[model samples]
Target chain A: MRGRRAFFGFLGKEVRHILRDWQTLLVLIGMPVAQVVLFGYAVRSDIRGINLAIVAPQPDAATASLASRFMDATDTYRVVASVADAASLEPQFRDGRVRQALMLPSGLAGALGRGEPVTIAVVTDGADPNTGSLMEASTLAIVRAWDAGRTGRRAGPRIDVETRMRFNPTLESVNLFVPGLIAYVLTIVSALMTAITIVREKEIGTMEMLLASPLRPYQIVLGKVAPYVALGFLDVVLVLVAARLIFGVPVRGSNALMLAESLLYILTALGMGIVISTSTSTQRVAMMAALAGTMLPTLLLSGFIFPVSAMPWPLQAASNVVPARWFVVITRGVMLKGAGLADLWRETLILAGFTAALFVVGIRRLAVRLA
Target chain B: MKAATREPAGVGSGAAHPATNVGAAVQARGLTKRFGSVLALDHVSFEVAPGELFGFIGPDGAGKTTLFRLLTSLYLPDEGESRVIGHDPATDMWALRRRLGYMPGRFSLYPDLTVIENLQFYASVFDTTVAAQMDTIEPIWRQLAPFAGRRAAALSGGMKQKLALCCALVHSPSILFLDEPTTGVDAVSRREFWDLLARLREGGMTMLVSTPYMDEASRCDRVALMQQGRILRIDRPSAVRAAFPRPLLAVTAAGEGAAVRIGLLAALREHPDAASVWPFGSTLHFTDRRAGPDPARLATELGEWLAARGIAATVRPISATIEDAFMWDMTSAEPAA
Candidate 1:
């Protein structure tokens, strides 16, 4: 163990660096808040209006009028353009003018009048998997409603599945994503940013000057870890404040719990940073590794954006290793549901384990790598 | 000569002051180091007393930096052992670290921090504050104090070097390791910086500096001539110059036919008495093969040969320099010149 006086002394200097360079701290906190606000107001799961296209080739008065009812009724769908045949469908899809296309085959109205089986082909673009899935589901619901009205049926389909989006009853994308984005950006800036910084110093020879001093390796490590932690904590508060003021989002969880979770999350983040710093010999390598390692999973596999439950088993397993995944869970449990420690015990333990393991690995890496 | 003998009490010790004594600032034995396949130091052995200005003189890859690293405890020697101020670099590194200062070739001080801040930070790292060292670093600090608040990155190369020096000195260590400290500095700054080192010697601080500059090597109490990871020679600067085995001659010509005259003088190497001839300036620097070249005949013969080439010149003997010894040592094919 390092002497407390030296460790705390070095830690104090690091804190001084953090306080002086407050801009980095601001960015750390502000990023999550802004992301949350942007997602909350501008995105939603239950969309009001989606651009829809139709091709009713019969061109009869009743057919065209009924199609008009589907578009104008309750504002569920907005008619973008009408095509003549299957040939026009491809052109419309390629041009990106239509998300989902409706095709009522010839004599579709006569079949429907005779109560014969009538089915409308709903062709949807599969490029944007999220919106494409939404478009497909929403179009099916609207067409079913029209069929139900014609049959004079009051009862709906069996097995009424109710999805209650936790933390965000409205299923706002920002509400689900803002906290995770905060973790991502802060991790990038703190871990990856500072990792390259150490290599840069070593390259220029300043590390030699520092290493030659009486300060122990642990003292040096403490000094580096201290400043970034304060910055990370401050960033959490900044984003939270901005998120509430700008996006009308409230912290449902206790602020203290949120802070404690953030501290653990940053510990994991900074540990990875030290490992990276010790391994790399140059700033370029550090930057490349930092950017690629921090950005990818935070966006794709963290359950911050795409639901982890819906992801492939392998990807879900991979997400289990990513620190951001645990952080998002902790954030939602603490911030949205206002849950205490019990609600996040498992995730909290995982995060603590990651922090401890990374720290051990980082220290071992320093010992093996430096001299 | 008498004034030269009255050396400062804590400065350069007596002749044969190369022992790695108990109180010695630095000690190394058979210190061999290799970077990958490249042998940086081979069986290197040397010592610096408590207050000696020792220098490592050689070409770029002559293992100067490797030796410096071993001394500063930045590198662990592959073969030999080193004790800095009685602390084994391989084991008691943390303890050794407190008593030694190091300045690398490039400026490593934090660019974002001011000069004063950098000095203060380094000072506090050793459990001492900057205020206490203000008296010790007053001279160097006075030069940099005016712009102490500015970021170190924006300072001129010379100023940056000075600030780096100040930070290294702020802790007031027992020994200092400077690896090519003045390689990129200006001549004026180099002189001023060495002056500071001399003053530190006055206060009893051992310094081991490495440089490729032969001119600067002359100012050291003793220097080690290294090449290919081995020490070729180690002695006082004056002795190294004196030990050159050949008598030297200096020549000059300020006329338009100087090149023609220099060309003919080079042709003297074919003569029985002429050992080697090299161009130093407008004229040729020549050395006698044996001893006592007939000056009258040599001058007359060279004058006639120059006249044949429509050239005019003058020649006379001059003192040998450290560069001459280095050049002679590098190319064994060339007879002693």
Candidate 2:
């Protein structure tokens, strides 16, 4: 098409605008880097040094060894108090001295030696469900290991189930957070940046000039979003670099595939931006709409912070429509799980389908407005 | 005048009284456009010959910008048809776009880009470069050469308008649509801008320029005098002025004091024969309610009437300008059937 040359010319113009405008530069480079560093370190979900109180009323060597082994299980928990009686366990939890408490009954070792059933009570603060559940799981794992070791020396009832954490063996939240962070940064930056830039053109009245020119609506949209795709990919690299080098998050899968999928997601975001810009005529309204439209959906609905499966049925269905949800799945699958396209073709296809759908809708809306 | 005042054709009426000659650059028949409930351009029809400097003269909200936008193919009309360079703007907008250059009423060039960048960008959009059309825009671009590195937003109003015009012409289109090229410009700069247009006319470029200033009407080869989205008259500037049906009197208060001016204005408005008395600079242009064959007797009567109010004034008959004709047309309720 003869419009190809004009497309590049307009693309160059949009690139120059992005390069010259400090606000756009700030949004493009500064915000993503800052949010990644913040989310990686300060705002991360890794919980450490959860205080635990142990109460062993019998005061036997087996109960004390069990308590000591639980404390040494992982850095996630610490034995803050060793209560002499069960009466003081409740006080330690109430006074905020301990977030979790482990109670070994008086006959725990006797019951094991005599082949009688024994019950260990693990109490945790339910104020924060995430931390509480994590503490409870840690206590169970330690207790299970101790019982299994004792059962090997003698005959006892045990179910041997080996649990393997496939992707992040250490279960480090950094690995999980990094992928979500990339989704968030790319969505907000690319979508918001493209939206505000187009709205600015409309506000300044240059859009009418473009419409009056020989440049078609598709070329105009492409010229606008082509630069943003590059910017978004650059942000993807910056986030991945910071996540890998700074936070020690890994990229175990194909980096090329990860980047290609990221580019597809970025296109989806840019398409959303064009749609928003077409609906709005001013930069302020566009900015507000972008933030409201992309930020909340990416953060809450994309499984970036909360798990989609654990969400309500309606919310889970809604998340399927969020572009970032599929991207996040692809990012986690490729980067954390070392998966290939064969493993992630479904998510990739969904993202591609979304990009195409949004681009079509955006172009049609733009044509309507221009008409 | 008969050709100029031909009634706009009704909706979907094909080629009624085609004013489009072989040399016509643009033609519109019953081109009515509405924005929601607001009637922007109503049953408006006109044509411009190739290489002619045509002007649409009206005050603000007179639909001058709307007509320019419609002809530029930026908006589709609700009814009727418009052809630019022998192509319908409604259907053949893309083909027409390559042949037309439009400078919108607002300063719309990239504000962050340098003047040269803006020029180069627009030229490239037309699949050419600015260097290819240097001779065409040289007279204007040379004036803007020193400020090539300056951002468009930093340029003064006149310089900004010049840069806009230069960008619009960078592609060397067959027709140029300038919507109020000198609305807010200083008097000196406005004159210079029109002088530039006159030079463009010499090189045989078809231009359709709109302006709110009545004085600039004389600069055009012909003008469509518009008000409230309706064309009242279209003719040469002198003819439009001569079309003013009533005689005009320039009433000058014979004192330098502001109080004398105010008192004279108040006394004249109170006069029974004063049809309309509007301030024109320090003096006043007064139109009598009654048309009379005897101008000398009317002037004498106006002088005695001012003296009767103890305000010294002089009344003299003067030729009506476009402004007088516009005011007369605006105040009239209906166009002559």
Candidate 3:
């Protein structure tokens, strides 16, 4: 009973420390909401408001009607310019006034009247390959739809291909990022925050007094990290709520499972933090180590922005060790895919393994006495 | 004190072996520690009697902090062993930690925490409450009560020290280890802090305090003069001063000026019979080569010697202080190096 009271006292002290630092508290609570809003609005994969130039050497009813079709096919394509010659569209593409250009052959109405085979070319700027390809595909889809509507019969022998995006059908990038955002925010809030807090005690010499007290090293470690766990959970909930209310992302799976997995991941990140604090004697070094050691790996190697399967073999193997990698999978699986324990037990096990291993290393590395 | 009766029974029993079963409140036999290439504490050994106020007096880097850390179990010795309140700091630190209170060399309390909050936090950590040990810390806490709501960082150096002391004493530990409790504090506050320690000592509380100020040594029941990780001497303040083995003289010129004092010191160092000369405050301390000499004869001779050198000065034989004894031991022990 006495030990439990001491642990709570230590835990209360840790909470008081965080509460008194208003700037840090602001960052702790506000950073997640701000990051979610920023990334949700800024990072987009869907094509919208794309400028298009129609090149027609001859103006005719067919060409004018086709230009109208491009303009009327949703707001995805906005006819920014209509040039009489294909040569005139060069400056439009060069200066980025136009992102895509649809070129119709000369005498296109006469050819269609003669029922002759003719091809139309779709030109696009490929500076950013991802958006460039998306624009081209969207332009093609519009042109195919227009052609099919114009012809009474189907176009000669074509292999029609249809693609369906599962989970996030509209392919909203925010849907993918929200899950990763939970992992990212928790990693920073748990690992980086805990590491710096622990190192601050060492820097200010309070760790010496704590070590000299009746509290065991494990008790100290647990007390120091307990507050962060709560804060991390709050961050996860905040990000989840913002994702749902603001970004329209859904947690299709069990809310309890998502929360449980997030708690587990927070523990893993905090374990990483404890290991970091044990090795560093100053706050500056611990901050740098946490950023470089945990944050960087979570951002780059966890398949948050980039797929781990597409990385090199060595990087793929390295990604397996980043706790955030497993967490991202678990969160995306549970939040988006509605996966339960049956589908996510492997990732869950790996995360638990990481937490266990990191905590054992952290506790063992923590010295009972000063070196 | 309310908690005085709660003192552990095994403290003075001396039941265990390992050279610490001498019934001392704190004991060490050849405790040593090293940090990289620096030998922080050599094979140092000492003991503090129960209810005694023991002080380790030394300048910076004299291993006073290192010794306190070892005694408090904040550090483990590389060689030998130590026992605090009859519990080996190495093997039995849990019991030792609960029974001992440590105020580290630095202000270890949460700077952002209010004074009362810091006190309450420490009290709870020890499985006690501030109200329970109010009698033990009442003297210091009464002074700190006015600033109870203030953050510790805003307190004056002296107030900070008092709050730190209050926090250490909140649990009413059997013994206390205070490392340089008054290093940066003002002179008046330093005196006040020592007076507080004296009151605590009167209550039969065993304490081990370290300080870099030599004048503070006189207030300790017994002081260990430490230097370069070694204890030069350990005894009562008066006895340590009396142990100065050389005849010493205090020389000062009639005119009070920096130039006159500097000139007097230079000339005294050049004297053939002068063993060592150091500037002490407004006067210069002069030691002769001969061991035991009559004070009047030596003073007259030194006065005449300075007069013959065309520099008139007043020379008087003065008894050694703890500082003088410390300087003597430090200088005498340096020749071998």
Candidate 4:
């Protein structure tokens, strides 16, 4: 008998085994989708509803209007404290009553009447840098708007420049996590399934039967991995659909390109699984190796939760070996940046090279073990 | 003459090969294997002719399963050469795999798949469907047909062995290697399983079976008595029994009680010339240090010796079996000497 028919027969049997076992089937689809939704909701980097403290040493009509303007304008800030002295700002901040404090010096209306510029101090908590920066920006916008209305004339040498955000104009964190989630989901599902499938055969004593057959080692590996490629892609589609429906994360680029890139990443992950399974004998060991060797590195180093650039130089260098890192970049580029293949050829090429390397090494190890 | 006249088929010897010799289904020369610090198989050598049902009979830890694994191409030997079905298992693994059927010692079939599904999968993996080879496995499958839908793990031990045999035979392999196929089976099933092997042998299927049950040695065409990673002797069962060099005696306690039997066994071991004594069922088998120890005189003296101890008993000269030979060989360093 030729190899192709036997290969397909083996693949069909594997698919049957997977489908017959309910626990394995559930884990295959459940873990990835849950992660996508969980990371999207719980790990967002957006801030809202900041508390404001206004310290007016001298109470006047200008300070009163300033306080009303902040409340009536946007939901970004609420006036939670009104103190008579600037010294009271310390306890307001220390007691968690306010995230930002505005200090208006004495005779603020008199200074404006004399045509002198008054310095209004704005101090914000710097514990959470993102929220702090956002508060500072909103505060300056409110102060400048009030001053512009009071003078009714242009400030010195003011230049009007328009800044526009492309792709994700709303800056929703889900848009970022959804693409990274695709890489993550495909990485874990493909690698884990591929790793455990071969080791399961080894554990059951079927591997000896397989090796004794005419099927080559490479044929056995390819057959075992072929079903998971399809399953992983199905998972990719499921995650993408869930993200779009639940979180409104848009896929602005070519959907075909995103799927194609995800498929490439899945192949890389499956290759990693083969490498893991060949080096280990039992399913327990293979699963541990897959989780520790592939999944954790993918989660930490792929810039999924933490940005890669903020990592130290040595860790940044080590992140290059992680396939998920490259895939994350490619997915984000295609989905969020609406980038084309031409723009992402470098990342795509790096992923292709890494996949080929892993596959070659894995197949070589499998062949050696079979021999 | 047996080796010279055996190759009428010329199946595995189309070419003049160094590793393969003509006529034999399997041939090994000085095969040695090791597992870390333990020497599993040490300098073992043997041959199985075409259509010969060869048995490796020994206690546990004898190199039977290790030799089986090596010959089946599931493992490589550290220090020797072997040819299975006309090719070196080390180099021609795939070529040899096409012609071999291997059932490992453990219950290694897929626990998740049903009995029938397991059979089908094994067949399909060898590029042959179960239906195509139905005639070959019909006997085993018929017994397993009633529990076809049950998972392999849920089957009884006897049924699991039958299912494993069916899967191994479903590919219609030319040579079969069964490692301890009857180890955990019931006595009736074990007998029936050997009957199946005999039938397969009659159909001209070469088989190598291993077992720890010494009684099953008489069922094989030839047997290799193995102990401690070495072959003590390899010959026909009758030859092995005849080669036991000492005079044997059987002593039975007249009173049918466990206490009397135990006292008899202990009393016989105290005899001056008794080299070894082991209880077989209700009777005790004893061997003398000398080859021709005057059977009647020894029996009377042993009877008198037990009578003096107030343990009534009867003693008689008896023929030795493979188990007796094995026991004698295990107790004494030299059997043939």
Candidate 5:
């Protein structure tokens, strides 16, 4: 209990410094807002006509009208140029005027009317896979819809599987990002700030005063970690509030479970901060290690933007070791799935185990230094 | 606090008895610390006797702080043994930590906590209370009681130092290690600070303080002059002065320019027995060579030589201080051309 009080005592002091500092406040609050707004509008999964060029070779009124109908349904996207044959599709696609080119053979319409097999070629640029996938999917849906209206049904039986993106029906970008953002902001600011702060004390000569006291070296290390863990929790509160107020992000999971998982995460993050502190001697080096080493991976590989399952196997495996990755999953499962502790008990235990392990490692490093 | 010319055997308070000798309270043999490829300390052997105001005087990068950290168990020496208060620092670090007080150079107390809170934080960690340390830290804490409510970071450098000293003393440790405690403080603060240290040293608390300031060397009972990770000499400041191995002459000119140029150079050439010619201030200092050298004759000959060069300067013999000893060690690190 005295250690708890000592812990809170350290935590309070750390919070005081962070609240009073202006630059850190700016970074913590400003970055999330900017990133959320930037990603929200810039990223989309559906594509329409998308600069379509028809290299039909033989133009028909029906084909031209079909292209017009396709553009009209997909909002703003339209057919930009009409070519005489398949030869023109390559040049138009390569010059970047179109995302894809539609090539229809001379007898394509006749074959479709006669119920004969008709093939249409869709040539695409594969540089951006996500964009390419979206373009291909949307175009196929439009063509299928058009064919269905012409004939009552296709020769082969078709089945529709209605998909609903739970919690985020429209798949809003902010909803997808809210939980990831919380983990990232908390992990980075908490781990980095405390780590650099302790190292800075050593550089300036203040660490000697702490070392001289009856305060065990581990106690000193804890005293430094305690304050930032509280700070990390405070950032979590800010993120939850901001997510709701700014982006309508729902917190569907159990509130207590969220807080508990977050506390475990804070422990791991603070442990990381302590590890970094013991390794570096200057504020500059500590800050670099914290930001470059921790923040970047949390943001990029934690399924914050690109889905981890969708990422290549190596990156997904690499993400497993990052504490932030677990935190993000916990955040999303709770915030979006409304999942209880029972649903995420395995993840929670892993986090608990991780925090304990890192704490032990950090304490051991401090002990070695003291010894 | 005594403002006497000569420091007594005892320090301020809680000092060890005057009977103990070097490293009796703290001892290290074959002590070495390697960080990757660079050796911060190499087989350094030293001791802090009980109740002695021992100082480790060295320039920046002289491994004073590293040695201090090793003594406090903030670092593990790779190849040597260290004992503090008869306890092996590596094995008995926790117990040793509970007995020793360390004051690092910077003001490391909680900047946001009230001065009392910072003291209490440290006290409580050791499982003691502020009431327990009233005797040990009262002399220093009295100065800070008025501003106990203020944050530690907001305090002036001198006040902060006093607060830090109070915090270190509150736990009542037997030995203390202060690493560059006076750095970044003003002159008045530095003098006042050393006075406080002298008072603490009198209490019979063994102290191993490292300082770059040469003036503070005189206030210590004994000093270890260090440079480039090696001890040049360790003795009483007076004794270190006595062992310079050559006579030192001071030269001054009425005109500052002539004193620096003609006087120092003329003195150098006029006496081929000159071991070293260094600019101490406005005038240059000429030290003796092993070959026979005369300060009086050298001054006269140097005066005529400078006159021939159209520069008039005064050259005379002067007392050597620890700074001379320090420069001697600094030059030792460098090879002669």
Candidate 6:
């Protein structure tokens, strides 16, 4: 009973510390909404309103119909100029007026009637490889459909391949980022914040007094991290609600399961934080370690923004050690695919293993007395 | 005090060795500690009887804080052993921690917490309530009550010390270890703090307090004069003063300005018979090399010697203070730099 009282007392002190620092509290509560909106609106993969230059040396019936087809294919393209040659589009491309240009050879409509092969080029500004490749692919698809329609032959020998995006139809990047945001926000809130709080005590000399007390090191750690667990959970909820209400991201799986998984990941992150605090003696070192050691890995190696399978084999092998990687997988599976435990048990088990390993390491390293 | 009734269990199981010393509040057999290449404490050994107000007097880097940490179980000794209240600090820290209160050298309370909240937090962590231990901390708490709602960081240095002391005492531990409780505090507050310690000692509490102020040594029942990780002397303040080995003189020139004082110190250092000369406050304390000289004869001789140098000075034989004894011991213990 006395031990419980002491633990509660320590917990209350930690909560008061969090509440009193209005700046940290603001960051804790406001960062999630800001990051979600920022990712959803600004960091989009879909393209819109791409300025296109149609350069046809001679305006023939075939060229005009092709230009009209490019314009009418989708809202993604806006024809800024229909010049006679590609040379006139250079100034437009340099001046930010055009991002992609379609060049057509001088031809009569008779060339197509005689079934002569024509060479067409889709020119794109490759300054940004992602947007450039996307524009090139979109232009090629439009030309293929236009050519197939012009041929008016549905009985041609062709091997048609169909592609469908699973879990996130229409390929909304917001659907992908929202689930990943939970992991990112929890890493910051749980690991970084907990490490800072613990190191602050060590910096200010309060850890000496706490160590001199009857409370064990484990008790002190649990009490210090208990408030962060609640705060991390609240952040997870805030991110989820914001994702649902603002981004329209769905929680296809059980909300209870998502929360349970989130709690486990928070504990794992907190364990990582405690381990960091044990190894570091100052708040600056702990903050740097948490950022470089946990946050960077969570963002870069966890498949949050980049797919893990696309990475080099070494990085793919190394990503297995990042706890957030498993968490991101579990969250994406639950939120998008509505995967049950049977489908996600592998990731969940890996996450639990990380939690166990990190916590055991953390507690064992937490010195009961100052060295 | 309530702690008296709750004598720590397993006291008999400790390696007390009652034959040598029974009921010693604190006992250490060559406690030593090192940090990297620096030896913070070197074979420091001492004993404090129960209800004794023991003080460790030293200047900065004297290992006072390190010794306190070792005794409080905040650190383990690199060599040797120590027992507090019949419990070994290294092996039996759990029960030892419950019965002792430690106020570290730095202000360890939460700076953002209100005064009362800090107090209550400490009280609860020890599994007690503030109201239950009110009687023990009432004297200090009464002064702190007016600022109960104020943040600890906003308190003056003296008030911060008082609040730290109140927090350390809130649990009514059987023994209290205070490390440099008065280093940065004002003179008036330092006196009040010592007086509070004196009152606690009268209530039969065992207190081990360390300070850099030599004047505060006179207030302790016994003081250990420490320097460079070693105890130079441990005795009653008066005994330490009485143990001064030289005939000391306080020399002051008539109408002496800072320039004249400097000249007088330089002149005295040149004197063949002058063993040691150091500026103490406004006057200079001088010790002679020869032994067994009549103080009056020495004073007259020194006065004549100064007169011959075209300086009017008063030379009076003065008794040694703890500071004087400390300077003597410190200078004699080390080789000339």
Each prediction's RMSD over C-alphas, in Å, is: 6.4, 3.6, 6.4, 5.8, 6.9, 6.2
List DockQ, one per candidate, in order.
0.36, 0.64, 0.67, 0.45, 0.36, 0.70
Question: What do the candidate models score in CA lDDT, each in turn?
Answer: 0.73, 0.82, 0.86, 0.81, 0.72, 0.86
What lDDT tens digits, residue by residue, belong to model 5 across residues A1-371?
A: 55664555555555566666768777866765555555544553434448877777767754665576666765625778777766666766787788877666676566566666566677777678867744654565555455666653333113231232334543455776778877787777667877887886677655655554445567677667765676667677777776677667778988888888888888888888888887888899998999877788888898886678778899999988888888887888999989888888888887788788877887777634532
lDDT of 3 by residue, A1-371 (tens): 89888988888889899999989999989999998998899766778888999989898977887888887865587899898887877887898999999888898777776766677888999998768866876776666556666764324113231241345544567887888889999999999998999889899988888888888878889999999999999999999999899978899999999999999999999999999999999999999999999999999999887778658999999999999999999999999889999999999999999999999999999988887
Q: Tell me the interface RMSD of model 6, in angstroms.
A: 0.7
lDDT of candidate 2 over A101-210, digit per residue (tens): 88878877677788766777888887888667656655666677678787433533343322422445445777887788888988887788888888887889898788
Candidate 2 residue-wise lDDT, B1-337, digit = tens: 3233333222221232234456578888888899999999988887777888888998898899888888888789998788899888888888898888999998889989999999999988899988889999999999999999999999988999999999899999899999999978999889989989999999999999999999999999887888788887777787788867776899998889888888888888988888788888888988888876566678888898878877788999888999988887766634542
Residues B246-299, candidate 5: write the lDDT tens digits: 667776765655536764566565666677777775667777675256667766
Off by over 4 Å in 4: A42-45, A53-76, A82-87, A100-171, A367-371, B1-21, B254-262, B334-337
Model 6 shows how many backbone clashes? 0
Q: After superposition, how far is residue A221 of candidate 1 from its true place, in Å?
A: 2.1
Where is the poorest 10-residue window by lDDT in model 1 chain A? A155-164
Q: In candidate 6 chain A, what residue range of length 10 has the lowest lDDT sum? A: A155-164
In terms of DockQ, which candidate is strongest?
6
Query: Clashing residue pairs, candidate 4?
Result: none
Candidate 1 regions off by >4 Å? A1-48, A51-76, A79-125, A136-169, A367-371, B1-23, B256-284, B291-311, B333-337
TM-scores vs. true structure, each candidate: 0.82, 0.92, 0.88, 0.87, 0.75, 0.88
The fnat of each candidate, in order, is: 0.56, 0.76, 0.83, 0.54, 0.56, 0.80
| Tens-digit lDDT track of model 3 for B1-337 | 1122111112232112122456778778788999989999988877777888888898899999988888887788899887788899888888888888899998899999999999999998899989999999999998999999999999999999999999999999899989999989999999999999999999999999999898999998888888888877777788778867889999988887899888888899999988899888888999898987797799999999999989988899999999998888888766533
C-alpha displacement of B161 in model 6, angstroms?
1.0
What residue runs in model 6 are displaced by over 4 Å at the alpha carbon?
A52-74, A79-125, A133-164, B1-20
Q: Model 5 shows how many backbone clashes?
A: 26
Native-referenced DockQ of model 2: 0.64
lDDT score of model 3?
A: 0.86
TM-score of 4: 0.87
Candidate 5: lDDT of A160? 31
- Measured on C-alpha atoms, candidate 4 has an lDDT of 0.81
Q: Supply every candidate's count of residue pairs whose N, Cα or C atoms clash at under 3 angstroms.
A: 4, 0, 0, 0, 26, 0
Q: What's the i-RMS of each model?
A: 3.2, 1.9, 0.9, 2.3, 3.5, 0.7
